[model samples]
Target: MSARPRPLLLGAGTAIAVAVTLSGCTQKASSEDGAVSVTASDSVCEVSKTELPAGHVSLALENKGSKITEVYVLFPDGRIAAERENIGPGTKATLVTELKAGDYEIACKPGMKGDGIRQKIALTGKDTAAERSPESDAAVAAYRSYVLAQAEQTLPRAQAFADAVKAGDIEKAKGLYASSRIGWERTEPVAESFGDIDPKVDVREDGLEDGQDPTTDWTGWHRLEKALWQDKKIGDRERELADQLMTDLNAWVKKVGTAEITPTSMANGAKSLLDEVARNKVTGEEERYSHTDLIDFKANLEGARRSYDLLKPIAQKNDPALAKELGQRFASLTGQLDAYRTDDGADEDSYTYTSYDMVSEAERKELSDGVNALAEPLSKLAAAVAK
Candidate 1:
């Protein structure tokens, strides 16, 4: 048996990799009016003014906390409107959000995990941001619609996979695993928002503190993957893990429907998806037991492309040059991936890919170069759309 590679996530306690905050693009608060000042420290979340006239609001957040922290503007029911994650101590970042007249909350996550400390905020006057930028609003709606649709498709398939495992049908369960993961991978950030559930549903084996100690530390999708493929049996433990995964995924599907999708989030999500490809999928680290890393690679690329498509109109309207470059780069990357595709000759998304281990070194190098090329233009997308 081949030695399993470490997974992208580590440990049950590890936080989901959130969006890389757009700190570099922030402007000085002194020059920007209607900017709300927020100061975060070890113990509390402080907002300069809790009451404000509604419209577009900029949050100038400074982290004085010792640990890396995050701040979020949440809807009353905990959907994220805007957030800045991974703000190191003594650093500052800005998040601009279009808020309407509604009840809201500001949550400061001091250590970047758990339910955050919250404070109520009041918004007066009508929401002018929606009226001001109809394009942006439409983009958000389109992305949300896409996510909800993916969720609907994912739920039944995921449940079937779980059911197969529970019934001790190892081969059937194995076949269903890759396809069932598409929706979850595509809408990862929204799933990550439900911190408690993400780990249960998607945490990989490397995420365990004791990878060798299956009894004590192992659970979730990769746990079942290892059992079916490596141990070659389905038993009591497999059944339990499958049941838990389905439960978490079911709750995730319902919960993410309420998630707020914004242009900034769309941009950040695209970058994060490619980041997944570069950091883990390209390295053949994601599906070590199954040797299906290429499947994840394709899924991450599709996820990134979907986000780019959602924001393309706004991005083009904002910066035509950058937008054109991005489109071309995406095409280049797609063509490169097209080379490795199996003769099944189905659509790009449904095309079956060869195992990563089967590809020659030179082919892998070309694929890696293509990913790097896409990353260059991909990184600029968030700031371009935000501007």
Candidate 2:
């Protein structure tokens, strides 16, 4: 089974086009209000403008492609500044983020695969420092600290899981698998911003790109997952991949400090986490072998909550009704998810849930509906906070 669209933070230089266009009378990319228009189709990705003043920028994405598409605003180094994924054919969505004066690229993936078509863009003007408030700055700082803490905690757990896999202890590795991913699930958008790390540490078998050799190119948690669950045997390749996974994770921990995080990014990331749940976890595609989708779903919810809580003050002050609606929606979704808990334990850190495969279609629909209800209000968060 092919995996659903997975989030990517970086791409290889060979796969991306980095040419910048300084002068063109091509389609108008930016509106008078400063939102850049992006038109994505099977063969082309057109932006309204190639250069603009730096600060808060919005990309209004229209997916003219036949397949679902995703768009990314990337730093010159390939780090993701902001992205909007899972825009269905003929549908439209918006992505908002903060950018400083520098060179960047706007990339569109028609089928949400490969490195995508790239258009180099330049952001010229003053820094965004003058436009920000102390509260918004604090929210960004707090979210950064939270992301760093999750990364710090993730390493030891992931190390333990890796050690079990390398030792060929199938039962121990299975035991540690879902718990090990909690930190990563909670802050996935941040990990993905690094571009090179997420695919190495988390990509599934079906998520492999064209020309990617499974025997050699496929290396990550899912590779080891198939070994333990489907093959029911450990081999040299699995052990080697286990070690590689740890190396990639350690690099991710080190890179978190340099991620481009902002108030709008935090709000946007919170919504994206919900999209992850709706698109993959709810469909039981993420953990096909282990049936651990619920664990990931819970972690994604927690991560979104963390971002929302950090920005709640600013959002509340800006739009009280939207803030209240978001609060209720989050709580409602939390309640729905809590019913799946397998343990009566009060410790959230030690909680578990029924395997995703065991969940009925009706239950999944209810969960999906809850996510949609929350997502509608959550989508307004970036604009609310940016005010």
Candidate 3:
């Protein structure tokens, strides 16, 4: 998986109304217009309001913290409704997401670690169901189905990989590793929304929480990757971690049906996928052990394409120029990625690419530039769909 506290960008648009107060974490209620003004410092997370009409909400986030911060809108059950990660110190960004009428919390994690400082909030008015058009509703339903299917397919592949690891079949485990991650790389936003699963299933070594002992604390695909590739052998501990990964993935598969899915979220998630490509895949930071980053890159692009294609009807109607540009950009980036393919005849799931370690720095730069070009136009997708 891509690194945690991943950088995110929301496209420019007319700001929606939601408010956050900057005082101490005292629970207060107010409904106000304009963007939710969120100020994150080293120890404080202040929102301008604790109450708002439920629908589309935008937070104008400014990070005052000395360390990078992450902000989340979370359901009471601990499921993340939406999140903006890697908000660097002294920088500002906007997070746009849809929320149904419910009680929730807005949490700010300074340094992008641990349970964060939180403020309780409530959304008044009816659920967003009546507010959304039938077309939007259909898009959400289709996306939910897609997400569930990916989760279902992932479980069996992950089981095979885990089984190989336990059997001490090093080469078998290595072969299964990249394939097992395909469904996950394709649908990470939904998986990450669960809050607890990503850390256990996908976290990289540098992404570990504070005070976590890498030996005992880290338990995920990347951990096993390190053991198989870097350490050059699987030990008893790797076997146990492999089993634990299966348990975590089972939980993710079971929970996929219940995840909050909305048109705006699907659009935003597509942009998030591109961001994943830029931050980790382009940098060659992801899949560093196996050098299978290209596989992940392709998966992320396909996932983003899936979301955009679903919402294309609405986007084309609302903003035809943007829709056209997006299509072209997606094509351009896809062409760039296709250049690295080692097996042209292979199916999407089984296509092989040049090992990332062998990718020249100049080639990496071209890929990065292509991703950035697509990402800029892709960022506008959420607002276009919402329109």
Candidate 4:
């Protein structure tokens, strides 16, 4: 609802998506190292925008810093073609550059900062086939790791922010949430180098954050936080909804340490939570946009459940506590999600100016039972096997 591009929430998510799409296949094949060598200042890459031809090339970057340095081809379209790492100050490191026919940039990161230092590399003709080459297997693996670390760091921080929200420290919660999001972003370019890693199935690989898409949809976990937690224009309408959302989220988090599991039990329970998230998807903005984007978020969460289910036997055999923890976390998140789908979510009080209505005792008990049932196999699995 703010004036900016929802930058705090979704910028990181959109960037990560492109990284996965482009991973591995971003560079051109290289047999030898030969590129137009340009000497850059400590600040800039010393190349104009239209300098490098749109084809295979390489850079032997010389870091003029006091410590380790890196130089990257920061493409205009968010494509990271090539980079050289650990280039010692005054020593040269070779980086192969494979560019397509478009405008591109080059920048040396942090230690050697001037301006973000821009360059425009233009391809005279089509180089899509040459440029979209498959990445080496190792490259893909490294990138996948980069993404997972990003997520692991982000999830906990977001939870902390949510906790602050639950405690009524709105300002503190907002600040923490912002800081947490910063962790998710900033390192995105690092993950961009990976080729061949698809996040949906690769738990090891970092999945793109959904909150950052330009189009109107809740992509990231905290994408709507800004809207819901703002000081201005947050009348009963916003505050009421915020409370509804958080109440569900809190209950979900509480369940994390206590959920029960087995494939059948987990599936039935998880599916219920999944339906809650799906049916309650926030119709925050009514703008017509890519339906696939909506479908993707829904599918990604669903896939996450499948992934958990596939690994259930392992949990059943070993690591039941993790299973309970994971199950509770998933359930909590889905329940919180249920609070957002204003139009279709069962919690109508958020969307309408209704009084405090509670879920039916029968329904509540069923959900509780479904979530906690997984503990049987999970506890056994943890006691008997390796996590």
Candidate that scores best on TM-score: 2
Candidate 1 positional error at 340, Å? 1.7
The TM-score ranking, best first, is 2, 3, 1, 4
Q: Model 3: per-residue lDDT, tens digit, 150-192? A: 8899989999999999999999999999989999999999988
Name the 10 consecutive residues with the lowest summed lDDT in model 1.
1-10
| Per-model TM against the reference | 0.72, 0.93, 0.90, 0.32
- Greater-lDDT candidate between 1 and 2: 2
Task: Give residue 356's lDDT in candidate 1 (0 to 100).
Answer: 83
Q: Which stretches of candidate 1 lie over 4 Å from their true place?
A: 1-128, 208-217, 347-349, 360-362
Each prediction's total of clashing residue pairs, residues at least 3 apart in sequence or on different chains, is 2, 5, 7, 28
Against the true structure, candidate 4 reaches a TM-score of 0.32
Cα shift from native, residue 358, model 1 (Å): 2.2
Q: Give the Å error, residue 97, model 1.
A: 6.6
lDDT value, residue 351 of candidate 1: 52
Candidate 2, residues 1-387, lDDT tens digits: the string is 125334344534434333454232135546666689988888788889887788888888888889888888887667788888889999988787888987787878888887778788788899986678888888888999999999999889999999999898999999999888999999999988887787788888888887879899988888888888889988889889889999999999999999888899999999889999998899998898999898899999999999999899999899999999988998999989989999885876557899888899999999999999999889888888877
Candidate 4: lDDT over CA atoms?
A: 0.37
lDDT of 3: 0.84
- Give per-residue CA lDDT, model 4, range 1-387, as digits (tens): 111110111122232222121211222322234444534444445432234455545454555556544555644434345544335667764444345565444555434222234444445666543332132223223334433554455456556655665556656754554444332232222222321111211111012333533333323333334443433223433344444444433433332332222222222223332322222222212101211112222332443454354545555445566676667765764463344233554532112211112334464344344434432233232122211
Q: Candidate 1 or 4, higher TM-score?
A: 1
